[model samples]
Target: MNTNRTPNPPRGDGHAHGFLGERAELVSALLALTVYLTGLILELTGNGGPATLPLFVAAYVFGGFFTLREALLTVRRGRFQVDFLMLIAAAGAAAIGKWEEGAVLLVLFSLGHALEGYAMGRARRSIEALGELAPRSALVLRAATPVEVPVEELVVGDTVLVRPHTRVPADGFVASGTGSLDQSAITGESIPVDKQPVADRAAALADPAAVDAGSRVFAGTVNGAGALDVVVTRLARDNTLARVVRMVQEAEERTSPTQRFTDRFQKVFVPGVLALVAVLLGIGALTGEPFADTFYRAMAVLVAASPCALAIATPAAVLSAVGRAARGGVLVKGGAPLEEFGRLRTIAFDKTGTLTEGRPRLTEAEAADGVGPQELLRTALAVQRLSDHPLAQAVVRDAPALLGAAPARSAEPAAVNLRAVIGRGVTAELDGEEVHIGSLAYADSLAGPPVPAALRERTRQLAESGRTTMLVRRGERYLGTLGLMDAPRPDAADTVAELRGLGVTRMVMLSGDDQRVADEVGRAVGMDEVRGGLMPQDKVTEVARLRAAERTAMIGDGVNDAPAMAGATVGVAMGAAGSAVALETADIALMSDDLRRLPFITGLSRRAGRIIRQNLWLSLGIVAVLVPATVMGMGIGPAVLVHEGSTLIVVANALRLLRYPDVREARARR
Candidate 1:
């Protein structure tokens, strides 16, 4: 290892630009500006003549250092870029004894590049901040002894001690201890999530619905109150932060349509401009125009028509918007997705986790004719309290609220002689009678192989409606049936409504869930279409059908959602903190399960597209005016100033996105 110096903090790309590469541009720009101002002031004040020649030459060297290097590198690679055009233009102006005009061109060119670099650097700060959030050293357990080691040295299967109030060392399951974790760093969850040991990796992976705060903890999230022994499931380099950064790096290479167009335009436009400048010079010679003046006009025209502003128009806005989205806990993969997201009028949602709360909740409670509602609920809660099944737990939670005609807190039911049948149901003694609370099958075996006709019908209706049914019986007499369902999230309906208000023409829900369950959720969320009982491939087929007609985005949160996500115009993964597959596969990742981020980012994308168009038109208009004006006797200095000024304006316009409003801020204003 090179021990001479400490490495800079890792950015999204895992490396930073070298000092001379970054500092040379900024420092050179500043130095060039200083020298140019000095010479111009001297000439303007009438205290300068031939004495300012050396100053202008020094200014040119300071400003053109990086530009010259870039020109040479591109030439060596058998290509010409904007830098080559810039270098040639400056040289031509100097050749005609117009050193001041040439200095202005080079100074502005370098300064514009420095500002562009700054914008790009700011765009990367969000991801870099996340990478930097992880601890530098992990307290590893070797032979049960705590040893501090660099996080990079950590490997899979290593155990790390996560002390209370400190950030987690790596992505892993909680092997021991109980506490709450502040996952705001990774998931944007403001509330601290209670956590407990969950060492079964396979079960957690197979059932991500069971993977909650207690099951999987990500690196960078703060541990709360209690210490935890975490088993490292991923290497430091392959943690969630690293994966997000790697994908962002990959996405950067896939630019927007406008950027691609400008790039192609430059390749042909540069050579064509060079040829046209030659024609203009030839025409001037034939007309007996002064040779020095003709060459100067050609150089001015080259600088004016460089198209630098047009080239940066799309990327600046895209990068700024992407960075802004990142700050709001939405990671847009690239320019393509950002632009596509803006134009999206249709989105497909997965039912089980995407639209619903993703966990069991009580939906219905029907008491028998003889039993009071409170008695039925109290007895059911008493029996279910002894069971750990998800449906039972949901009933135990929901029953207390319904004990009254007008739901409010009340007395607890006392149950004794509790017996829990694993993965099935629970039985207990309540009010001196044997009471059972479990699945219909389990209840039938104990209460009635043929229960009350009305009760059975109610149970059947609940099951057919996509609810998990739990029957309550006391002494072979059916008391009531409780319906458990994964209810729609509180924000789901609002999110769909906001999308509609944003001009979304279609809203679809595609799920692997039963047709009834999917339809129920779709109706609850006001979706335009509902396709249920879909396997992963079926979801992909639906997304493809949507793609054939209009731009569609697929939103989901599982390995199953990955393929459909890839099949759509843009794939978005909700609640990505706990799922590596979703994070890697989706084009956009919402760190939290906030449906509101959907509308916020969509609006952001549209705003970015608008700014990109504005920048493009402004840059193109300036170029159109300058090229003709320069050829028709406008001086080199003003032509260079106007051209560079437009590039600055484009960058500034794009920079506005860096301060774009998030949903909360937008709501507050309203």
Candidate 2:
């Protein structure tokens, strides 16, 4: 929740100053307790009168200063904070010659505040831990010599020398190196990812723009066992780690619905409490009770009715959950999304990247009558070699393995006059003959014979099975057709099933791919519906439709899906570590590309929502029982004990979420 208190700046692992510091409040509480105990001991020894009174006075002042200051500040702002009620209760106890009880009240209240601060500090440690991962300085390579420099001084296009076991200095493409890197800080991945040099023309022919294993490294990932010469692609402050830290900090500042409700409740409830105390004092004076007794009873009413537990209920739980979720690689933008995620009834996912590997793989190839398989393979490779599309890469990758030999990379006459038929296919002259390689319609567009019934039937079979068909032709003869499939992720089916297990009643796949391809992928992943061939705006319309019916979340990681994701009840960006826009645009960003994080985050949100409710009810339940009991004459000491005890209970319950088990770990156990 947004508090009047400005958030402390991003801290390192070291302790902060002031009352929020872990050690400061704790030391204050201990000092006050020590003085309080000394006062009790003096009274028991029958040497109490002036000496014990001084000790109690010292105890109250030391233990209650921060709370008293907060109470006064809140009063100056014309509001009644929970501390205001505690301050009044303690003052009334002191006025009634109950210095021992008032001292105890201050000490316990300060101790609770100390413990709560420590707990919240622990929660904020996740973001603080991120700050510690980046090194203050890095080795920059200037003019073929390595010179150590502050990270902030390194600019884009500057080369950096990253040594073995050192953190990557910046986000960049490797100039020369091959090694594994521990990316847990950015992606929450447990295993080290092996990276290779950026693709030369040959490798690009096989897999274009590959992310991992393609020399692209991010800042804060530890380089392993090998050195790298990296060309800095981003400034230090604009690195992936910096953006993650910033997003997390911004997310925590937002207020949840429950927190707002409590804030509003306090605005009314605090003044209501003051009026109730006034009525109690009025009735007691009318009934002829002594002024001291009447004042003591009103103080009891203040302590019993104060909403300390309620005031803290939502923030504690949200901060705890958001922190732990960040550690688990799920970035919840705020308590609003955290609460909305818990209520998500339907989840719409993009087909590629979200459910599938997002790249095509060659699966089947057929040669025409009287055409040998090797000849057909070589011919297809010769035509596809001139293109850079995903299907072309799929063909290029499998050609060598399938043929047991590489295509002839001759100096001349193998293929020439290559041309691209944008989104349709590629054409080239092979061995002094015109050749066409692409979809059936593109082949028809060329100066070629019509496709035979047999070839047409084969294309239909591949399309029906959700595979893209690439037809190869030599002059007027149908050469062959290759089937390419963008395979579903290994975890896709399990993720879909688990999401349903977690009460996601409706799951759909929205894709810009062919209808058959989309439907086949949805069936494999166990989705209830599949909508394919959608333009970007179409996805937005579908998401809006779903949101109008029920709470919906759109999970995507592409430019096309951004609008739709923005239109949903919650936008979940998968593999956000690779995309800065995803991190910024999504309400919930999963650092890793893994689909399983979805169910995990949803489950965690559900647990957080339940905890918030439990805390609220528990807080109000204590008030409902204690307020009337205090009015009916329960002593202030016991009432204070119960009131402060309930506040601690609510905080402790929220802290339990910090230890909530990870979904991946649970799956690993199974």
Best by TM-score: 2
TM-score of 2: 0.92
Candidate 2 C-alpha error for residue 305, in Å = 1.4
Model 1, residue pairs in steric clash:
none
lDDT of 2 by residue, 1-670 (tens): 1121225221111223233465776888788889999999989999788899889998898788767766776677677778888888888889899888789888887777777667666677755677678888999978888899999999977878889999997877777888899887777666788887765534532442244534678888999999888777778888878887777777767888888798899889989999999998899889999988898889888988988889888888997888778777788888899999998889999888889988898888888777787778888887777777778888888777887845356632367788887888887898778888889888777764788888889988998999999888888788788888898999899988888888999998999999999988888889999999998999999999999999999999945589999999999998887677888889999988878778779889999999999999999999999999988889777887787788889889998888888757555546
- What is the lDDT, from 0 to 100, of the residue 432 in candidate 1? 91
TM-score of each: 0.85, 0.92
In candidate 1, what are the lDDT values of residues 1-670, reduced to their tens digit? 1111112111112212434456667888899999889989999999788878888898899888877876776677676777888889899989888898899989988887776656556655544565677898999999989999999999877889998899998988887898888776666554677888876756754464456655688888888889998878788888876676556555556788777787788789889989989999999999999999999989988888888788778877886787677666677888889998898888989887788877889888888768777777777877777777777788877766776543333456577899887766778898798887778788767634457788889899998888878888888677888888899999899989988888788999987777887777888889989997888889889999999999999998847688888899999999876667777778889977777778888889989989988998998899889888988988877877787778778888988998886665455446
Residue 503 of model 1 has an lDDT of: 79
